[model samples]
Target: MSTAAERTTSPQPMNPDEEAFLRALGRVMTLLPRAIDADMMRDRQMPLSEYTALMNLSEAPGRQMRMNELATACMLSLSGMTRVVTRLESRGLAERVKCDEDARGLNAVLTDAGLARLREAWPAHLASVRRHVMDHLEGADLAAFTAVLNRFPL
Candidate 1:
């Protein structure tokens, strides 16, 4: 087995092919989010972040979860989630609840209205997801594609 030094010093220079691959990967990463954003714009007038927050709430236990936890789940800061939750609350999609179990904590609960919005949005969103991702692969390749995504770092 090669030592770490040998591996690090291996005369291999990541040349044009590796460079091009990295660039292509970066481009795909940049573009896919924009495409999803466009889909959200057309379907429900929801921004991607808001829609994502709603989806996180939808998947949570009892369609409700603590604000701090929801923020982390959606990769947003607490303040950011608070702002988004305010917007959602104004639209009747979500509401802030006094955590009865903890006087100092708060939770976000998706309302029936939120479920309606999710129901309205699901067909278009699922179609977009399939169009952009799932529909491109064959049987085995589909499994492999998901496996790769599952292993990706957060």
Candidate 2:
């Protein structure tokens, strides 16, 4: 077995190429969301997080999903999703309803207004996505990249 000191030691330095790759990944992770959110806000639409929550709800069966499930789908914490849903509710885009299968559980249901809002926002969102991300992938092996990304643990 390894000694305690050895186990607690810092990991070896990454090679130059590995370091460069990590740096680039970090930059993308930090910048991508801000860039997209900026574009959405510039167009007077909701921020990316809210937009994402709406999109996920729209895709759910019956246009409704349990709050916790919606949070997971949106890759947000329950509290974060609650805040987003609250904002959505204020805008008449979504509403919380008791889950039919489980009365104690609450579901976020997309309303007609919500669908309309999503439809209105779709064009701007599409344009932003293209400009910030898809356009850059032109002529690249997207399938390969997708395969690699799919390997990541959720």
Candidate 3:
């Protein structure tokens, strides 16, 4: 087996194009969610995180997911997902139920209200996504871009 040092080769300096791409990726990572969230909030809709949670729940099998799985799917920490689910519960949009197979675990289930809210928010969300992202990618190879994105660890 190779020693740790042998396995740890120095990374090459980024080329100018690579540097520019990295900078742009960083900016997008920072700005995209804020832009989408602002658009949603400005329109008197739920924030992007809540919308995302609802959307994920709406698409899950039986419109429910285990809390931890939901958190992973929503790119949130478990505690963060709990907070979002709590906000949703207060609004009658979602509820937490004891997991059927695992009594110790919980699941987040979307209510009819949540589905309705998601439907209401969909148009504005789509517009925001288009304005902030898709429009900029006009004529770009989306399949290739998606493939490149899939290379990253979730």
Candidate 4:
């Protein structure tokens, strides 16, 4: 294995095929989020981020998670996650609670309203996933696809 210094200082140049592949990957990454967001906004009146927050909370124990943990799960900063939760709270979809184990920590809990919103949004979200991604993979091995995607660094 190459040392960190060697890896950083002697980085390999991308060949033409690799360059093409990277470009395609970049496009998909860029476009997919926008497409998902648009679908959610149009059909459910919720942003993708809000839907993501609700989904994460719904799957968590007690339908709640610490703000920082939820932030990490949503790929957002703690402050950003706080804002998202605040919005949900305003909508009566979620609420913040004091963490029993840690005074300094707060948890975001999904409300019944939040669960109902999630139920309503599920169809649109699933449709977006199928239309934009899964539907294209006819006969493709998903395990292989997942494995290959996981090999790349974030």
Q: Choose the strongest candidate by lDDT.
A: 4
Index of the highest-TM-score prediction: 3
Q: For candidate 1, give the lDDT of residue 68.
A: 95
Expressed as tens digits, the lDDT of each residue in 1-154 for candidate 2 is 6677876795557899999999998998899889989998889468998889889988998999999999999888999999999999998999999989979999999999999898888888999889988999999999999999899998
User: What is candidate 4's CA lDDT for residue 148?
Assistant: 94
Per-candidate local distance difference test? 0.87, 0.91, 0.95, 0.96
Candidate 2 yields a Cα-based lDDT of 0.91
lDDT of 1 by residue, 8-63 (tens): 89956679999898898798788877898799889868777788888999999899
* TM-score, every prediction: 0.81, 0.90, 0.94, 0.93
lDDT of 2 at 48: 91
lDDT comparison, 1 vs 3, better candidate = 3
Candidate 4: tens digits of C-alpha lDDT, residues 1-154? 8899998999988999999999999999999989999999999899999999999999999999999999999999999999999999999999999999988899999999999999999999999999999988999999999999899887
Cα RMSD for candidates in order: 2.8, 3.2, 2.6, 1.7
Ranking by TM-score: 3, 4, 2, 1
> For each candidate, how many residue pairs have backbone atoms clashing (under 3 Å)?
0, 0, 0, 0
Poorest 10 consecutive residues by lDDT, candidate 1: 133-142
Q: By the TM-score metric, which is better: model 3 or model 4?
A: 3
Question: How many pairs of residues collide in model 2?
Answer: 0
Give candidate 1 misplaced runs (Cα > 4 Å).
1-17, 138-140
Name model 3 segments beyond 4 Å from true.
Answer: 1-7
* lDDT tens readout by residue for model 3, 1-154: 6667766775557999999999999999999999999999988468999999999999999999999999999999999999999999999999999999989999999999999999999999999999999999999999999998999986
